[model samples]
Target chain A: MVTRPPVIAEWLVRQTAPADMREALLGDLCEEFVLRGSPGGRRWYWKQALVSAAQWVPASLLLLLPGYLLPLWLLDRLWALLLSSIPLKEDAVRAWPMLAINLVVACLLGAAVRLPSGALVLGAAVLILAASVRLPLDYCCLFLVLPALASKWPARKVKRV
Target chain B: MKEYLGEFEQLVMLALLRLGDSAYGMSVRREIEARTGRDIAIGAVYATLDRLEGKGMVASKTGEATEDRGGRAKRMFLPTAAGLSALQASREAVARMSQGLELEGLVW
Candidate 1:
């Protein structure tokens, strides 16, 4: 017996087109796939990724500017200290190279927000946060909050008079 | 006024006619694939169908959902009078264009 109609699969594949139009279709597919594959795991992954990205990126960078700055500065200092402790330390190493690299990466990540590949960047950030962080809850919060807010922020509509 | 249909649009309308009143998104898609052996996208079919419907060449209604389709109602299509006329005109045009063509020496 022929199982499900070939058309359904063909239809689903066709939905992945027009480049711009593919995101919503793919998003829905991803959602459905996750729901079917592992409901609990998907829920946790979404909670961490979407929810945290939405929260942290804005709350830290935009809303609480000073608070965010303090934490980032501290983190940078700690990273510098950790790097300094390594045996291959030279004066050039302790200089502005690490800070410049961080800045460049941050800029690239920000620029990626406008591209279609932003999803990949967001996914990577979520995965990195999830794996490396000690406080799972905080990482999850940041991952979910930042991307969600960034993605959904309403574009300013120009009134065509 | 003969509005030119794209190749895919022609294929879809022809498929719908062949499918009769049973023509819907999934069925039409399957018919096209089976007949033409072309892998078509579902979004393209729906989008084109919606355009054709807007042009008054086709009409559609939502049909009962089935268990296998995740409870999604199928959108059924039927060719309007204009649609049939368009198909006939397109067929005649193609026939007229290829009338005297000789393919004996052409590579098979």
Candidate 2:
């Protein structure tokens, strides 16, 4: 009888794992899961999944940090420049451009970090985090949606062979 | 002077040496856990393996896929000459540091 590991756990591992090592890592986990049997194996699988996600998520975040932040900074400067030139007050009325800028940045960042196993979830989480601090409802929704949309483009794919 | 291997890297290399042809992720993790009684994560093993490979201290080959592993191929690793020498240097460095040293509660 073939005993399988937890589906969600396996998916988590597959999603967050570095592409180059994903196959071997998954194989190791599966083999071990079989060896340990179902009772304790399921729990062990979840533990490994969490541990692996912990390792990869931090590394991915660090690598994507500059990719995400630099664009935001540049666009913020541009927004400031626009406000200064147009004689517009830096109030809610003037904030629409900032929202637009954030959406563009979010899309670029999502594309930059998109992985094979649906890592747009990570992008969405990051966007929501940024949104939580300063964005209003409409801006937050756009921030959330744009990344998920941009992640679909095949041009910016980052998968390994 | 050769660069010294970190403690975990040394363990991974030693495990590779012990496993010989079967020095893949699962076996390596099991070998270390059985001997050291430390619960080693497979992810940690692969990360260290990748780092070792990056440093040219190890080389790996993609092995045949097995049904037990859901048809996923094994990536087998072996320590390089540099890895062996680095492990030796690390061991010697520790041994030299501990030479003729005795703690208050322990006898040599």
Candidate 3:
């Protein structure tokens, strides 16, 4: 059996100072560490962000990619008209534009997941654009609803015996 | 009254007191771990030592670079008069707190 390091817990505890002034000091240190992205702390943040992106990319590809692609694949004539109606000719427009939009949306989604408050403003902008385009309600809802629902689920709940 | 030294601070000071002129980061860390069975992180130990030195409770000087530590110079520490006094006062306080308590047969 492997014995736990005696000082490991203490060191971890010391990392998060007391509930008094020291707590504020440690908080400041953490904030500075994040902002500076120093060698000591940046690796952990990068690892976490990459893990979050790994979860997010697959989900976005599954959910949004199908919706975005199915319109072009199944309703090719209607999709051409939709593109032409936006004041851009079908042939003048390239698949690159749609891909670019998807990439931007993915980046925005990643940012929203990482920073919720900032993402709220971006979400509002997307909602306005979606409304202008008269896009399906579910499309608009996907951006706002999913994130809100995910945020509401408590990580751990306590129950009284 | 002087503020109470934290447990890690107390440990580092005590190690310096015991090691006298030979107190350095690795040696002091090893000494504390041997005595207390606490495997402290090197970063935490160095940070605490920096704080203690800042408070003038300990004094440190850079020694010659060594091969084992990637050719890094060792920072040797020695307890100041204030450190010794602080350690003595902390010990006395603990002793006073336990003076009347019969802890012999207690589970604690």
Estimate every model's Cα lDDT from 0 to 1: 0.52, 0.76, 0.50
Model 3 stretches with alpha carbons more than 4 Å out:
A1-161
* lDDT for A109 (candidate 3): 49
Model 3 lDDT tens row, B19-53: 88877765776789899997564445655766676
Please name the candidate that would achieve the greatest lDDT relative to the true structure: 2
Candidate 2 lands at a TM-score of 0.78
The candidate maximizing DockQ is: 2
Model 1 residue B50 CA deviation in Å? 1.7
Off by over 4 Å in 2: A79-95, A98-121, A136-161
lDDT of 3 by residue, A81-154 (tens): 56656765656744422433443454444444442211222334445656777765655654554333323323
Across residues B14-107, which tens digit of lDDT does each residue of candidate 2 receive?
Answer: 9999999989998999999999999999999998988888777888888889887989999888888888999999999999999999867896
Q: After superposition, how far is residue A93 of candidate 1 from its true place, in Å?
A: 34
Prediction RMSDs, each to the true structure: 14.0, 4.7, 17.9
Give the candidates in order of DockQ, highest first: 2, 1, 3
The runs of at least 3 residues in candidate 1 whose Cα sits more than 4 Å from the true structure, single-residue gaps closed, are A1-161
DockQ of all candidates, in order? 0.06, 0.43, 0.02
